[model samples]
Target: MQPNSVSPASEKQHIVIVGGGMTGGLLAVLLAEQGLTVTVLDGAPAPVMPTGPAQLRVSTLTEASHWLLQNSGVWEYLDMSRVQPYDAMQVWDQDGTGEVLFRAREVGAQSLGWLLENGHLAAALYRRAADYPNLHWRCGVAVEGARREEGRWQVRAGDEQWQADLLVGADGARSRVRDWAGISGGARDSGHHALVATIATALPHNACARQVFMESGPLALLPLYSDPQQGEQRQCSIVWSGWPERIARLREAAPADFAAELQAATGEALGEVTLLSERAVFPIQERHASSYVAAGLALVGDAAHVIHPLAGQGVNLGLLDAAVLAEEVERATQSGRSCADSAALARYQRRRRGENLLMQNAMRGFQQLFGQRALPVRWLRNTGMRWVNQAGPLKRLFASQAMGRGADLPVRARPRA
Candidate 1:
């Protein structure tokens, strides 16, 4: 099933997944697993761990994501030692009220989620992708332009043109395939920026993820695996969200000064903090495509939608999008349907669009509720959270959704339970 060995089936499907980042590479592996010829074109070489000053971004992997990766044949290959599990989550207002605690034990689960360095996940996917004989990896190549012809796509990038029966856009927030397919996107600025960095702590962390909501914004401290060099050393990835002006000041401050600012912001949630990397800021914005599929093309990952990171759901949403689309292709093929048929692609779009929309709306609602500065509104929200915290069933429901295992999951992702 190697790309060069692929022969014409009754109806062969040539799928081109552009932008070989995490989603793109993983999509390539999944599609190829369905016995389809997949070519993953990227503008850069393989993913690598950062050796620079940038804080290595981290992602919260829900149980469902872990399952998908495991089912997709990646879990066994990943460096499990670098991934840390969190059995509980603690959230409190920086104003020192509205405190809530959610434990996995309450839901009869082992861990609520996992904390993984983004680079580690990317590397794992890239390495696993190499084992898929049907996948063609064309690295260090950028798509200069693309066009459609004769019910197929003719993508021109670098010095080559790739012809495919259908194209998938996994190129991220500012996707070029979306542009080529004429998919329009609506975006709104959240008027905030997030400062992300890694910090060393003196406390044992106890496998709990913490988030403190300040008037400026929510400061999150995600526990990381213990430092390798120092046996007792602990570290946490910190994401400080706030206004643009304030973000700039923090980013410009000395490392020691910034660490002090972060410690005060978190109220020393995990104890003494020592800066471990250069602080980086990312603008918070909301974006969504007008449509996810058209003709012989479809959008996946950040190319299709983006939401506020208030709940750390962006990557989880993208992974779901990928899992659903790959499932649709398989179901269609098995049911004697055309992989590139408009009907099939439309079905994938319907499922993904609805799911992404719901999550986006929910995240926005949560952000609005938590971001309010009014005293009465704040008190009401605090009271509501307090009630929700005490409601055991309701807390489990919320935790399930955050774990990407809710009833709202796409039909393809639903388990028999």
Candidate 2:
């Protein structure tokens, strides 16, 4: 296709992305690919260096997310060896009494998901973005605020002012763009903080993910490829959820002491564990923005919504937003409409907002069911899970949604089926 024609006097509808994280960077890459000029304004560089005192977090990429990255031309440049695939997941009670298992083999997929470091994925996307001439990377620049002017968006960053046909707020949970757009959000605190850490295990995890549910909350153990320097070292990242008092005690424990406690907490699911690094804690909360778009502004990723980490869907949801928005822009442009046209923006808002609401409701239902302590409720929930695990058709249906395939997505997001 030839480059999009523009009049000498006509503004090119410059798009200003407020965050250079995964969502913002991906959006910039996608929009630039469509022949639009974009400038990503972020306080940090694309390949963000992890701070020593900061915690290391991992993200699980679903099959649908993989498709999005592949389409955006980022996945091909990623280090496949650094990403570990988990074909199966096992969930059981903390006491090792009841259990349920999910396997991609049963659903005829290669794997359920891939576990990878956030930095690795971001680096791959950032490197690919630099190749696009239409994408202007503006790092180490912070945005103070955004306001709507006469038929345009005005953004204040540092000591300068920038104008755009539309502004995207990918800044995160505390999004300044969302605030400027006058969007409200609701939050729920589960009263539990997850203690996340990496540890070396004696036994091989063999590409399996495990989640043990206790009365307090769920404890997740995700296996990753061994580190290069540590030979025969099997590493698994742990997210242990418990009450504040218990978490406080665990945080204060010595490295060896905490490792033992974690091993017992997981019932030696991945074998003996040794703490290899410092512990990090993240409080549990669910947030949802009232609306995704307003006049010449929109929100993506965590800035739009957040859910419980028990299902590992946060990053996946963000990527889905990028995909849907790109499709909307592509469709609008092909039909002789501008990128920020009101009709095009409304189409995006209607579809993405509905999909996010469904996922949020499903997550809330799971949280309520799992947090129940009644004996009858526990037995009923376990039995239901067991039945679901045995039913082939039902299992496939649920797994398809988890993989981000099937009919759950909007019409624009579905590939063929």
Candidate 3:
């Protein structure tokens, strides 16, 4: 239902969320499912079921994230035919003999992760959210202002105004809600730009995701569904990162030249590459909010932190943020406290910020390590990778982390009984 028809204000705890993209949309559903009133303000129109060929933008959903979607009733709305489950992952260095392979069987799991277009996931979330009567969707409505008054949040969109017990900013990297709330944060460029595109490969991807680390940056070839007519598992999505000038040149190069370069980059691992979609490039930036919560207001997803996409964990981290915040809100309610209790928001921040920071720093370290040109540094990294591959416990540890299996996962993301 559109937000034009205002529901009679009730005593139910209400939440106002700005930005109804993937993360905010999920948050709205999670809160509304708990009997809380949620209103989502999104500048973009309501999402519809994505169709036709895959989009250039995509996201990798880890096992934990998958569980969150399933438990929240969003997974069923997705088109399973478009979901690509990768059973294995391979990482290697282009400059050295450092190679490591992780298979689902090693961890007793059926698949490592699922890859799907970003639009598909967002649309599925909006579809599931529609099932909740308590959820109000304000499509094509931009939040113009936000502030605190009388222990509640006052949000304004054009001439419309809303008050809520809690206010959340899930509006992505350049969150206006965050700015209005006076949350402090900074973004640092990673000195690299990622060029993303969909491609058709001569050889089947074999349900495997692969990445090759070069001095410039890392290039990942993630598996996707095969072409229906051809019925060959050759469809893949590529994220190639490098210096701004280098990425610019690659983005403008002829399709054949680009495909040739892609083939060379992967050492023909997937055989000759054929560009099937237009390429898009985006600068890499690392951002973190100095504090995730202030009073009844909180930030989640990219509004709170944004890390490198090297491991495809950006979306996973955002999903975890939504889950943890929901859990904390539920915990506060059960304990006879307000859903926007400061302690609850603090707990959510405490649980998420450290982990997100760790991953961000880790990615920075990996980039710097691989970017090194010294011979000793190169040998050390290559030998370390080989040793880790040979070490069963270490390999399993890495695999488990990549699959989002950790002790501190929010209750919603945990495996079902």
Top-lDDT structure, candidate number: 3
User: All models: lDDT?
Assistant: 0.80, 0.78, 0.90
How well does candidate 2 score on lDDT at residue 238? 77
Pairs with backbone N, CA or C atoms under 3 Å apart (clashes), candidate 3? none
After superposition, which runs of candidate 2 have C-alpha atoms over 4 Å from their true positions?
1-13, 48-55, 229-233, 408-417
TM-score of 1: 0.93
lDDT of 3 by residue, 1-417 (tens): 233334644433389888888889889899988888888888998887777788999999999999999999999989998999999999999999999999999988999999999989989988887788888887788888888889988787777788889999999999887898888867899999999999998889999999999999999999987778535788999999999999999999999999999999999999988898999999998899998998899999999999888999999999999999999999998888898998999999999999999999999999999999899999999999999999999999999999899789998888665
Better of 1 and 2 by TM-score: 1
lDDT of 1 at 238: 79
State the RMSD for candidate 2. 3.9
Off by over 4 Å in 3: 1-13
The positional error of residue 311 in candidate 1, measured at the CA in angstroms, is 1.0
Give the per-residue Cα lDDT of candidate 3 at 386.
99
